[model samples]
Target: DAGITQSPRHKVTETGTPVTLRCHQTENHRYMYWYRQDPGHGLRLIHYSYGVKDTDKGEVSDGYSVSRSKTEDFLLTLESATSSQTSVYFCAISLRVFDTEAFFGQGTRLTVV
Candidate 1:
């Protein structure tokens, strides 16, 4: 286990609303990532922060954003929720090699109506 947790294990929201998901870690890992897992598309990265104040967009970052001002916390926000964004979200942390296996939080199931 990588000592990671995600809040609101499940969420339901209307379209056009704003939502934020939180990721917390206890190991003080240097890398944290937010990814969305869809049925056929697999797990796609939304954003990642390598360190405090050091963040970058990932492959599927268009409708999402992230921030990390501390080593143990990373936040993901959906500016405006959309039905297209309904998916299971997962947070991961990396502490070993670059391709090191990541540990995932239980996941947050988001549904936008």
Candidate 2:
């Protein structure tokens, strides 16, 4: 199984503040992804990087950005947090083909008020 972990498993923040969440992987996978899981919405991709310095926005990329400077680390940043952004964020790593299942971290619970 792939090894992946996320930092700041739980966080609470005020509106208009900036927050960063970190993801680290030991599997040396070629693809990394950040997603948010909300009730009734399933998991929506926030951002993903195929390779170092090569990232692209996902369906819900607004109010969020990501960076992957090294193969082992990926970071997600919220420039200005908001209540609507409060949700559980997950990090995943995939080296397998598209049909194969990816591995996910425990997740980070973020709450904004």
TM-score of each: 0.95, 0.96
Lowest-scoring 10 consecutive residues by lDDT in candidate 2?
A: 93-102
List the RMSD of every prediction in angstroms.
1.0, 1.0
Computed on alpha carbons, the lDDT of every model, listed in order, comes to: 0.93, 0.95
Best by lDDT: 2
Model 2, residue 70: C-alpha shift (Å)? 0.2
Which residue pairs does candidate 2 place in steric collision? none
Stretches > 4 Å off in candidate 2:
none
RMSD of 2: 1.0
Q: Candidate 2's residue-wise lDDT over 1-113, tens digit each?
A: 56898999999999999999999999989899999999999999999999999999999999998999999999999999999999999999988648777899999999999
